[model samples]
Target: MIIRVRDQFDAYSTNTNKVLEAGIDLKTRLFSEGGDSPYANIIAVNSKRVNDPAIVALVKALKTDKTKKFIKEKYKGAVIPAK
Candidate 1:
């Protein structure tokens, strides 16, 4: 799965480690104004960005260890989907 970082700030943290530990190979990318892709399973936007409901949902989803582990196991060492 492709995990797109909403911005540079969101991408620059140990938060990705939590995803990595779960087994997914995270691909960080900046959220462009006209960019949208179905391949990105999660879009981790910084709280300071626009208060998008989707981003909020993604953040909530990543809050639990079980969710992280599930994501990790689901994508473990697998090539991220093309966007």
Candidate 2:
């Protein structure tokens, strides 16, 4: 069945044993198509809050290599870090 990359992870979790047996393929356009996927995890900051220390820190933390590594390890190919 057609599903987004992130949603496929959810399907994988629920159908870990059945996926291979059922012959279901979960492929993501992000990797296969070599083009940008419309889906993304965005962090929108308000104009006024852009300079807030907490917001700044949060954004910094999210963009760190450590965070990227965590996302890569935890989500496998399901989630991609923003560039």
Candidate 3:
């Protein structure tokens, strides 16, 4: 039997196949934006100044404690910065 729904609810609720992204609990994040996956959110810029000092500075800025905290708070464990 196949029942079409609006979004991933059918998959999340196990109303359909067991190939859903959810676990036993109703609140489980298997694969988030930046939890621990290789293929995840990517920040890329195609420009001649890609390797410029400004770009390096930008990356360094993202490693600050405040920035990390902000991401943690705002994203609520949904996004994890690279190591």
Candidate 4:
């Protein structure tokens, strides 16, 4: 009966194995990513740095399939990437 953000439960410090061993179910889908409680996680960039090569590269990397796959594999179903 722990209600919190899906991503929080997937963190390395969450001790998910212990929680599961304690009979806490993690597969229950209570709310979807965009059904009713629509939320977004944003990365804010400095206006002055928007055109910097590093920032451009980072943004480009984030929009790639590799990044999406990494997110899916690392976070499992906890984090959903918006298409």
What is candidate 3's CA lDDT for residue 62?
88
Per-model TM-score on C-alpha atoms: 0.28, 0.54, 0.48, 0.54
Error of 2 at 50 (Å): 0.7
lDDT of 4 by residue, 1-83 (tens): 34344356753334443444454465653434442335555668889988999988987898899998987787566656555
User: Which scores greater on TM-score, model 3 or model 4?
Assistant: 4
- Candidate with the larger lDDT of 1 and 4: 4
Error of 2 at 40 (Å): 1.7
Task: Name the lDDT value of residue 61 in candidate 1.
Answer: 69
lDDT (Cα atoms) of all candidates against the true structure: 0.49, 0.59, 0.53, 0.61
Off by over 4 Å in 4: 1-25, 28-32, 35-38
> Could you tell me which 10 consecutive residues in candidate 2 have the lowest summed lDDT?
26-35
Q: List the candidates ranked by TM-score, beginning with the highest.
A: 2, 4, 3, 1
Instruction: Tell me, by lDDT, which candidate is best.
Output: 4
| Residue pairs with clashing backbones, model 2 | none
lDDT of 1 by residue, 10-83 (tens): 34334334556554445542332122434344565666874887776766667667776675576553323223
RMSD of 2: 8.4
| Superposition TM-score, candidate 3 onto the true structure | 0.48
